[model samples]
Target: MSPMTIDSPVAGTAPATGPAPAVRLRGLTKSFGANRVVDPLDLDIAQNEFFSILGPSGCGKTTLMRMITGFETPTAGSIELDGRNVDGVATRQRDLNMLFQSYALFPHLSVYENVAFELRVRRTPKREIDDRVRAALELVRLSAFADRKPAALSGGQRQRVALARAVVGRPAVVLLDEPLGALDQKLRKEMQFELKRMQREVGITFIYVTHDQEEALTMSDRIAVMSEGRIQQIGTPTEIYDTPASRFVAGFIGSCNLIDGVADAATGRFTIPGVGEVPVDEIPDAAPGTPLTLAVRPERVRVLPDGARTEGGVHLPATLTQRVFLGDEWISHLALDSGIVLSASVPSGDAARALAATADGARVTVSWHPSDSRVIPTGELA
Candidate 1:
């Protein structure tokens, strides 16, 4: 296999900044018998990009990663890396390394040996292998634990050994298959930063696969939201969260108050039965009376000063269903007369405390700006 060098990008080379994507998938498909695991997936990941493929269990996210890393063959289409085709390339031939979900470290082996395993298999020079292993260990802050058996290391340390093994290969791209799934919640959170730092230090393209939304949002430069063997949408974490393109993307990324409504392009608004006329930004393709879904992030709705509204947009008389203090914010769950229950996250400042003093089940007005709502485009999300 030809060697690919890894170097830290100079200043201004943040994630997603560069020339062509380090990896691109064109019309890729994979099937088992008649069941398609990955259905005609298309994606591009820029050089040194920390890209995540996120979805639920049956979403085929794992299958897509496998194809990219050459662990599983795609039934059709091509895998391109650095502008060259690699459809028939075996796993070892591709400049890729993987950190398995299980850590997959050789438990019986010493940490140093496990970290050096890849180099030994490839007949790397003994002196070079030692240097690489030590470097990799230091990169993961595990150099001090190098000689311990895998069994003797803590879960996080064992995880570092797996990561050390993968980066020791010095591959151009690294695939992390739910690398933090095994750690406890607090530990997993800590590892998220560690993994991102490792990627930056090594300057290799990282294609991390996970079903955890928070993990992806915290670590990725871009995310491909996958479901049912396909990618629903791909964008930066903020893009995916703030402006989800479809119903699925909106509903999937986080909590949403989805209302079934109808749209009239002439009026540029949704005509919900009980909620009444709600103005919208863009006139959707759907004609009047067409069944549509309206999405609003819970935090976008406002329960504010009495008589705050002067003009258009919907405001339903509501009652506070529940309220919870969530650190820096107070989460108020409101139940509207329109049968819509939504959460409003208000900053836990003086104003929020005053509002909290209002009686639970107290009547209030829930309002939203036109720009705050998204009319889920028909057919954009299945």
Candidate 2:
């Protein structure tokens, strides 16, 4: 496919920003009657950034998007784009384009016409419209299929058409609400890179919305994890995954080992019940005998022989209960003396086979580095 030149943002309307964000929401909120679909929220997305809104169903991701797209007005707060306030602007006037999950392609129009529909509505000159549409099609690598109808193309192809339509207009930001939800697993994986590369080449800010945690992690430069009509945390995937600010974030984003224990302020350590006591990072605000929860990631937990010595953290006996072969890695469900299970992933063939043992009954010890664990206060702030 040939590389294409994308039109720059509208003159002065999409001003340059450094560390500053292209979009900002301050105390933004919306409601359908008494039901608060989207509670008061604050967020800032950097220029040319790939930011995703992720959460479980009914978590206000869609409502927030509606507010951003002008489909739904905020009941309170302010929204700004390119350092200008546009909280009450209409959808068409908001300098943004949304690619719907349904593709929403007009059956009567061919791919070329469907993509050029907006340009035609704006009364753009015929020659320029053709040039832009052709370039947009190439961005998604679907130039040859421009003459085909939505019904004539595969799900992935139709999605690219929808994406092409959105980018053809060169909106300030592209809003994708589960854009890849329609494609099959393999095709969806492929489209992830295609969409990301297209975003990079276009240099348009992307505000993506999805309920799939893995999808959000894979594509987003930064993510806002929402729940109960509010954003719980916002950070890069690595920061959110490695150092989740709250229990809700730690548990929701990925698999974690939660160990309940009590923190001793005087000695600055915690003793996990049915496990062992270990010194902890100094938590200045926590009182003595305060109960806490330790969140540990699977990769951070390792298995060892009965007498194997490691750096800090609790060590307890575990019985190999089940081993799952997951192509790239092997996930083992090990039952500990506390009746709680700890899962660890190793390479599929060699690394996993190195620890081969009797399933359901083999015994071993598990340990984690002291810094690998997080001592979260039981009473977390949301």
Candidate 3:
């Protein structure tokens, strides 16, 4: 097989960054009969980087993680960890640990024993085991619960125990598969920060898998967005959200209004069947009449006040069809006279109040700058 090259804008993969990556996968693929779950996947994760594999269900993220963990052998490809090919290495022998959604603690064991399980199993000195166990518990803010059993801890506390156990061995990487999935929304949000802090303090690579976009956005240094057995894009959260490379990414990372049309290279405009003669700058380098899609985030769009005019942006006559107040902001649903529908987010306070006061069915205009929107091939939308 030829040398694998990851062409995406992955951080720390350039020639100037020396030495081996924390984890590398080349042509990684998994197939079951007629179905290919992960197809020709290649990736490089840097040491101490919080990398996340984000995709919706059935997108093969877990299978890919299993391949790295040695729990599931790849049908074809190679996995290298810190410069060593680990394709045939035993799961337990790999220098990494995995934490699952269920916490998976030993119910019969005390919290101290649970955190110390791996060390005890390996027959470490009793004195060293006690010291490490106490330190790990303190690291996770669970030292007070050391004598308690799994049944005596809260969901979040149990998760901390799992994290402590995963890092107690000082492994090269920590594989977290939806470790926050079992917690309530408030607790889940709280644990996101906790996990990030833990990973930083431990100074180990983290390969997290989750379908939740917010979780990936909040905690990852770099994210690999996957879909249909392949990576759609890989970049920082801001890069993925602000300058998505494809329609799927534009729509998936957060809410965005995707307007399908064909570009007019000569006029620097796009023509949609419902919305006519939309002026969009920075059009992708394509010949006139090429199919294109305009992507603009909801927050970037604005509902122009009565008789308000835009200086250098596109505007269309629209009607306020629905409005929702979300405390922190307001969502205004609109329909254009030409049949296009879109949404705009108004911040709370005066602006939201004004939009909220506007009667439904009132005429309005929605406008956005060309720079605030992205143009991509129309066929990229999922």
Candidate 4:
């Protein structure tokens, strides 16, 4: 793909120049026949922020996106854009554009016409329409293919044409609904960077929705993880990944080893069934026997020889059940004596080579620093 160029904001409109957020939801919600898809939700998306709504399928992310685009009316509360209430505003009246997984381009029209369709419908002057369409095409690096029909373009090219169409109007926010779902892995990765760059160059707020964790982590300035009609947590990628506020957020963002336990606040230790007491850095301000769920990322756990000292770490005796080689890291699956499972990640160098040389059923001790464990409410374990 050629380097995309974004010269200026859409022809007639200036960039969103404000300290106010681009979009805000106050008590926003939606329900269907007693099933609330999106519960009362409040979110503030800043101007030019590449915010992503990430969750599993049926997690209300799409419904939330629709509410933002005005396609779905909220059951209660208000939708605001640029600090102005947009209640009862029609979809077309909202300052936003939506791009879906499918490239909804007109097959009979050339790329140029497809991109210019919106301008024509709005009765924009012919000169302005011509200039905006060309500019959008160039921004996506599809200017050379402007004369081609949708059928003549590849899947990525077709999608870019759709992007051009949506962005030519210079909406305050662009809502993307798994827009890269139809592409292969390689193309999807390439488009992630391209989308981020296009967003930066155009200086438009992008609200991307995806189930792919890596995609959200790669492209978003911040992410909102949703589940069961509510947000689990909202934060930057590192914060979400490193310090998930809930069990759902920890497991959803990446692989984790969640152990059920009861904490002894006085001793700063948590006791797990089948495993011995585990060290906790700071005890929660709870009773001595408070039930807690401890979460540790797979990569945070260290594997050592069976007799290695476990000082300053929670130690568990285990036997390697399996090992899988990822390009950059090796995953060692271990089964604890208590029958619980744990996954430990070994970097793809000496440790990985050493583990690979060890027998599959060899004994090992898994340990993690007390600070590496995140303690959350035991209710999430249910």
| Number of the top lDDT candidate | 4
lDDT tens digits, residues 1-382, model 3? 0001111222343332467898999999999888999898889999999999888899898889889888899999999887677867777767777776455788999989988887876787899889888888988999999999999999999888888888887888888888899889999999999989988987999999998999999999999999978998999999988988888888889899998888877787788886688777768877777778899899999998755788897888899999988889999998988788899999998878888889999999888988888888766533
Could you arrange the candidates by lDDT from highest to lowest? 4, 3, 1, 2
The predicted structure with the larger lDDT, 2 or 3, is: 3
- Each prediction's RMSD over C-alphas, in Å, is 5.0, 3.8, 6.0, 4.3
Question: lDDT of model 2 at residue 20?
Answer: 54
lDDT-wise, the better of 1 and 3 is 3
Q: How well is each residue in 1-382 modelled by candidate 2, as lDDT tens digits? A: 1111123433446554555567899999888899988878888888899999988898888788878777778999998876767755566766778776455788888999989888887788999999999999999999999999889998889888888988898877888889888778999889989988999999999999988888889898999998879888899999999888777788889888877888777777778788667666755366677777888888777777665777665677888788787778777887878787888776756557766653557787777777888877665464
Error in Å for residue 38 of model 1: 1.3
Worst 10 residues of 1 by lDDT: 1-10
lDDT at residue 210 of model 4 (Cα atoms):
95
As a TM-score, model 2 comes out at: 0.91
Clashing pairs in 1: none
> Model 1, range 1-382, lDDT digits (tens) per residue?
1122232322232344347678989999999999988888778898999999889888897788778877788999998876667767667666677766665677778989988776776778999999999999999999889889988988888888888888887877888889888889999998999999989999989999998999999999999998888888899999999888777788778878878878888878787788688788876676567777888887788886545564665677788888988899888888877777888878878868877888897888888877888887645554
Q: What C-alpha root-mean-square deviation, in Å, does candidate 2 show against the real structure?
A: 3.8
lDDT measured at residue 84 in model 3 versus the true structure, 0 to 100: 72
Give lDDT: candidate 4, residue 279. Answer: 81
Clashing pairs in 3: none
